[model samples]
Target: MTVPPEPEDRGTLTISPSVVRKIAQHAADRVDGTTRAERRIAGLGLGTHGASAKVGGEGNDVDPVLDVALHYPAPVRRIVGDLRARVTEEVERITSYQVRDISVTVSALLPDIAPRVR
Candidate 1:
């Protein structure tokens, strides 16, 4: 004979930090004005402009730091504010984890050299 499932509750679901980081990263990527820094390989720089995220969580809580490069003439505060909200919502919704806080770092402010098309 096998045991039946309980209706009220069951076991806990654990979401890892890396998973949360990826969630936050994706959310940040979706936002407009978010740019990534270059990746250098053997003195050769390569990589698309985008954003990177780091997440730390304790138990069911998570906090993330987003590093985004800025394209000149962009609205800074509005961009960061939007990025924070989006990351929080996605992390919580997908992982069912509480987002403690979000810290944003302005990695770089690139000159209006080449405008990227979204």
Candidate 2:
């Protein structure tokens, strides 16, 4: 049998997409009443575990965007609004990159089930 040719290795500096997602998620969760319910956003096709890196552009000069899906216990609209503002703030503060946009998609409105005070 003939030997298969070896695959060429290109030194490409690539970062997984999850990194940006995690950073965005963490920042969003830190918002007073916001929480990241699920790991991944189905429609958006964002993975739970990934990493993102800046390819190259004058050292973080380009604005980055973080798409988010939120699950709230009440007032979906209000919660979504708050999430957008908070995500933008946190990402900008931590990464020092201008937020191109924050798209907040409300996934679900869960009921606030209270626990019994024993």
Candidate 3:
């Protein structure tokens, strides 16, 4: 996807990093059994909850690095494949920026738990 440049007289348009991050996080979350990991060092006191997205590359070509967690009992490979494709498609479609590369890291694996009855 190519982001259209602003008219010469109108000035340039810029996309915010936060926006890109949100897009990536949401896309990753859409995949079944996938959860976004919090931005924190492993074994640190900080809690994990949401994924992170980092956008890079030149011009309209943007690469996104996604950090996430997957629930146990799910097919890891399949979930990752879906995540990569979904994130790339959604980010490109929403931002109109070319997704040159998408890197997915499995930050953690959460165990499946049964719901409590009232």
Candidate 4:
């Protein structure tokens, strides 16, 4: 019989769309001024908000649509730009895929709350 390949050499790597979206979302959350928002429906508490992304495309080209919440009184334009760049860089770096386009939706603007010091 012929010799078999090594265990480490025989597997193919795959990066799923969900994984790409998660990576992009996590990356977006890491930037400054990006924060989680509390979600409510009809005066009921649903849950807290986090940046989310939907990734799609063929081959190694990825298109992600991101929904994010930002802090109030912050520069929205600049922060969104930063978020876009960061997401693109992180997704491409992690997956070795090209991020062709990113669509960002600013879902909410939350107040920047600080804890009181006694």
Best by lDDT: 4
> Candidate 2, clashing residue pairs?
16-51, 18-50, 18-51, 19-50, 19-51
Segments of candidate 3 deviating more than 4 angstroms: 1-9, 36-48, 115-117
Q: Write the per-residue lDDT of candidate 2 for residues 43-97, one digit (tens) a residue.
A: 6745342112221223343333434433344565676577667766865576665
lDDT for 49 in candidate 4 is 68
C-alpha lDDT of all candidate models, in order = 0.83, 0.50, 0.82, 0.92
Kindly list the per-residue Cα lDDT of model 3 for residues 40-117, writing each as its tens digit. 677575765766777777777888898888987679999999989999899889988888888888878888667897
Tens-digit lDDT track for model 1 on 1-118? 9787794467767777888988888899888887666777898978775778788768888889889887767899999999999998998899889999999998887765655775
Q: What is the lDDT of residue 39 in candidate 3?
A: 53
Per-prediction TM-score to the true structure, in the order listed: 0.82, 0.49, 0.76, 0.83
| Candidate 4 collision pairs | none
Candidate 2: where are CA atoms >4 Å away? 1-17, 32-73, 115-118
Report per-prediction Cα RMSD to one decimal.
3.4, 11.3, 6.0, 3.1
lDDT for residue 31 in candidate 3, whole number 0-100 = 86
Residues 17-106, candidate 4: write the lDDT tens digits: 999989999999999999998888999998896898888898899999999999897899999999999999999899999999999999
Ranked candidates (lDDT, high to low):
4, 1, 3, 2
